[model samples]
Target: MKLKNNHIATFLLSFLLTFLCAIPSIAQTPNSTYTIEQGDWLSKISKKAYDSPHLYYRIIEGTNEKATSDASFLKINSANDIRIGQKIWIPGLPSPKNLTHVPKTDCEIRLWYNYQIVAVGVINEKWMQDGIDLETRAHKAYDLRHKARVNARFMMQDKEAVKTLQARDIKKYGNPDGPTFTYLLNKSMEGGQSQEVAYQTIIDSSSKTDTRYNADCQ
Candidate 1:
């Protein structure tokens, strides 16, 4: 009889422990909301909220299902089509914190540019080899460029600066083709100018070239 009672006590104790352990998971729920503003898109919001732009689907699933019947405020056709002033329910997002801002110095910029040039060169060599179709090479090159830009953003800690650099490069050299980036990189290294100065020089030269081409076309 004592052994039977001991078995019952042990079973109750184990059940109590299991139930207690599961309480936290069961009690936790999604309780946060986000108000949309200008330039607010799911990808950008997810990137800001969750540190990954790929999780935009979570916002759609969490918010749209709970949307009011009128659908005037929370209706979303696509992640890209979110309207300003709409309220979005965001689940499982951590509280927002200020982003760490690293100082942007000339040497850091130059180092980033050097690393990007090398990375792009390797990608081009690997993808542009014989027997690779032009479409495949183009797709690979685009992916490489995106990865390099993301890496550069991390190193530079300034998205605007990276965008400016790429835009200027595109304006000067037409797309971000590997050879053009390599040439500018070599020139910057040899010239010993600050990145700001080198960038200005490239922009000025590109403007002049455009003017000459336009004149020639007339």
Candidate 2:
């Protein structure tokens, strides 16, 4: 029996995550075939062939059963694997011989990470508002969480106090960066500091906090 590769899981996870997040627009459309090449993500290929990247998931969903069962599935940069010269079914597309059309722009971005909250800047009640799309909002949320995590790591708080905050599961209150303000407050409280001291500490380090939260949530 041949051993299965770990990269397959990674690829499936990446693909599935994106698929679950967005509603595929080309689910019922026709398909075309193409040979794989270097540095080709599904989005890039879909964009090249369909004129839109949002339709990649439809292709994946169409071919997922085959890809899932194969041992050499979804390998990164492996020429003998799922790389160059591999014939792939491009779903929700037309015949390559008849494909001479450019896909229109549909300002969107896809994210493959996690998020706890959607930003206020990206969401509104309008049917087609000017704010960022859901995909871009997801990416921005991840970026915000990552930045918060980094900030939490380098925060100039007492080590023991910070540890105490972590031990208390403060991350549940906010993104992966830890609680925007509660993490520091927890640390300060652990260190026997008053609310005034905590507020002053934040004021002193205001340059580092996220400017979006500087004005407080309305």
TM-scores, each model vs. reference: 0.29, 0.26
The stretch of ten residues in a row with the least summed lDDT in candidate 2 is 106-115
Which tens-of-lDDT digit does each residue in 1-218 have in candidate 2? 12356778778999999987575333322465555656666666756766654445445544543456664334232212355656566644222331233222110000111011122112222312656554343334444545644544444245675465566554465543345565655665688887766654433232122212211211
Per-residue CA lDDT of candidate 1, range 73-133, in tens? 4756566767766777766632222123332553444344333433443454455566665
User: What are the clashing pairs of model 2?
Assistant: 51-103, 148-177, 149-177
- The numbered model that scores best in TM-score is 1
> lDDT of model 2 at residue 194?
79
